[model samples]
Target: MKVIVGLGNPGSEYAHTRHNIGFEVIDYLSEQESIRLTKNKFNALFGKGKIGDTDVLLVKPLTYMNASGEAVGPLLHFFKLDTADLLVIQDDMDLPIGKIRLRQKGSAGGHNGIKSVIQHVGTQEFARIKVGIGHPQHTREAVVRYVLQGFQGDDRAAIDAAIERSTSAVKAWLTQPFSQVMNMYNSNK
Candidate 1:
């Protein structure tokens, strides 16, 4: 079984924020599969279903962004799933807008959610897809505010495109190997 976790804060206030891109992707995937994320477990909102023969659990950690690791660790233990069977989707402020990057294993690059997951899992060997939200032109505080806020105009369109691409990429990842999925979707050129 594969567990696909999308990192973000919960609640309507954060619904359209750049930080909630992870949640947006997962929600799109759930809708495509006609699955409702009604199951609450391991400090997360999730649902179970098969995606192209791969048993999948779509998750949105209710532990919020920073402490996401706490929920992921226990859930993996309960399900007897290894790091290899996990995939995380999140927004990246460092990348240029509209770009997507997939990595098999790496550091969090200062993302608190990924940092927490690493701390709990005790490894960085999980697969991940990062949706670019672009960095702010001004100070760090501006970047924080921008991400926590919401996307609009062309930015919203980019986010929507990313979600559509992520749905395809994730479904491909479940059935095919990581390399294949990366080759097909992880492109900026």
Candidate 2:
């Protein structure tokens, strides 16, 4: 079975933060499939279902962003799945707002969540979908505060569209070889 993990900090305080965009994608997919993320295991809230013909487990890690590996690594082990069977989705500040990038394997690029995953999973050779949140225009603001802030106005529109696009990418991964999906998705500008 394939696993789709969405990285985000848990708790109501972080609900709509820019850093929680991964959670937003998970919520969208769950809603589309009518699956409730009620099961609590692997330090995550998840639901079992099919994405196209592929059996999948949709997960939202509850270990918060930095400790995401706490959830992902165990789930991989519990499911008897290889690193290749896992897909992680998280926000990225390196691209323009609303952009998405899919890579077969890579360094964390400064994302704590991805770093933790790499540490626990013991490799960077895994799949990940990076949804760009974009850095704040105001350079003076603390990076942490900026990521924790909610999107507003045009930023909101961009992020909303990105989330929809991200959902489409996830669907493609469930059906096609991930390399093919990466080709189709990583080209998005």
Candidate 3:
């Protein structure tokens, strides 16, 4: 089975924030596939269903962003899945808003959630889709505040478009090879 994990903090307060874009994609996919995220396991909300002919598990880590690995690692272990069967969706401050990038494997590049996943999973070799959220000021406090805040006006429109593209990319991954999906989506950026 393929596992698609979207990283985000739990609670209504964080809903729609830039950091929650990953969760947004998972929500969109769930709605589109009629996959109900009714199961709570390994500190995550997840559901099982078919995407095309492929069996898929949609996951939203409830352990928040920084501790995401605590949930993901155990789930993969329970299912006897290798890192190759995982796909993580997350927001990226380094890319411009509305842009999306897919990578077969890489370091976290300062994303604590991805860092946590790498830590617990014990590897950097997993597929990931990053939705750009646009970086704010260089200050640490500014970055924190920016990611946790909701998008506004034009930014919101851009983010919405990005989310749609991200979901499409994810669906494509279910059927296509990771490298092919990366080439198809990354070239659009």
Give the top-scoring candidate (lDDT): 3
Selected candidate, larger lDDT, 2 vs 3: 3
Q: Residues 130-182, candidate 1, lDDT per residue (tens digit)?
A: 99999986787887789888888998898898889878888888888998789
- Give a tens-digit lDDT track for model 2, residues 3-28: 88889999999997989999999999
Candidate closer to the true structure by lDDT (higher is better), 1 or 2: 1
TM-score winner between candidates 1 and 2? 1
Q: Write the per-residue lDDT of candidate 3 for residues 24-68, one digit (tens) a residue.
A: 999999999999999999999999999999889999999999999
lDDT of 2 at 88: 91
Which residue pairs show backbone clashes in model 1? none
C-alpha TM-scores of all predictions: 0.96, 0.95, 0.98
Q: Give candidate 2 misplaced runs (Cα > 4 Å).
A: 137-141
- Model 2, residue pairs in steric clash: none
- If the candidates were sorted by their TM-score against the true structure, best first, what order would they fall in? 3, 1, 2
What are the RMSD figures for all models against the true structure?
1.2, 1.6, 0.8
Total backbone clashes of candidate 2, pairs 3 or more residues apart or in separate chains: 0
Rank list by lDDT: 3, 1, 2
